[model samples]
Target: MSLAVAGEEHEESGGRLKAIIFGGLDGILTSFAIIAGAHGANLGPVPMLALGISNVLADALSMGAGEFLSSRSYNSYVLKEREREMWELKNHPEGEIAEMVQLFVARGMSRVDAEVVIERMAKYEEFFVDIMMKEELSLPVPSEEDTLESLKDGIAMFLAFALFGMLPLACYILAGMLAPSLDVTSLFSVACVATAISLFALGAFKARFHDKRYLYAGVETVLLGGACAAVSYFVGRAVSQFAGFEQLEFVIQYEQQPTVL
Candidate 1:
């Protein structure tokens, strides 16, 4: 690929990575919270599944939509600024050229050399404006295909949230469907371990992207997930007790119900 194509691809990859990290982190934490809280309250498998699935879908959509709108708004702002720069260049060519020369001088070029460079650049209006946009406004022009790229980012976020967020509830879901006679507590315990592992793996992936220490990043993410789970679980338990919810019996009765012919 040409340099420009390579750069665009790199930027696109970076955007996707950001969306994945954001969506995955949110998905894991939110799903884990729901599972931990429900388990602490001694809720039944049906109710836990309902909460987990609902949260995964609803929150994933919200995050994706939010990202799309935010990206569009940023692009709009950048375009507006570029328009302003274009206007200034048209109405004040001499001043703009002088500004470019001063910018080059500020960067350690001799004044005469700066003038010569600016004069040559000024021969090409588009190139001159680009240089001014970068040096004067400190704004790099975005890729022309950013709209499609933004859409890709949103889709990536939604997929990541849906897939990774299901980790904490996956074990329970599988057990309920595949082995109804299995111990509920054991299933939940397995789900907790899976969630921890997922969080660590996500952090390691993030660290790899940012060139950080993978082990430390993994540990940090795991600790964060554990802390969130602990808080949600304890708070749920406390509330259930205070309200006399009696969720344990309800769950037991639900599990014990006979299948109707």
Candidate 2:
């Protein structure tokens, strides 16, 4: 029986889930950091919205491109190793067969059965290559239509990042549009709550694929994100104070004397 067949479905789903979790986590954390820092610096809604939107788009694109390149690199390396294995199989059949027999023996198959199994597998070149890729190279065989699949994974990451990453700024932007009279502190408080809920939900979603309890995972993720935001907030606060930036704001009033013009 081919071991790959048994786990192929599981691996595919797991890979996609991982991409979503990774992208979501990154998006929420980064945007929250920017929001926290802006709040600490006592910035207005316009600046916060500008910073948050800029980070979201730039970071999502960078992450998607990075994922695509990384997947492509891994695919290339696997192809090269597969080529090497095929060459060795053709030029040194005895050595390759011995390695296969050893692998089976180590799995508790008797030497006689191991040799018999390898001999039968060798009769089919495709099956022999599959075994060598799995056992010798310790790599899953690449899917035949993987290029499009990789692209989809990258797009998934970008979309997840953009959606989840906007949470920290969502409340601020909405409040600015809906209620200009709202205090900065009130707006920031709402943003904090939204970010916390998002962090917890993402953690729980990720935990479904692992052995950890969902509540524990949720709390852990929230704590991590909170800690990062807290650090960023304090740093921004300290920098702003040291630079005396708070005193730099100016409100200009035009006097009726301007009619002299």
How does each model score on lDDT?
A: 0.86, 0.85
Report the number of the highest-TM-score candidate.
Answer: 2
Q: Per-residue alpha-carbon lDDT of model 2 for 177-261, expressed as tens digits? A: 7988888888888888888899999899888888758999999999999999999899988988866744443212333235664
For candidate 2, which ten residues in a row score worst on lDDT? 248-257
For model 1, state the Cα shift of residue 156 in Å: 0.7
**What TM-score does each of the candidates earn?**
0.82, 0.85
Off by over 4 Å in 1: 1-15, 245-261
lDDT of candidate 1 at residue 93, scale 0 to 100: 83
- Residue 234's lDDT in candidate 2: 95
Instruction: In candidate 2, list every pair of residues with a backbone clash.
Output: none
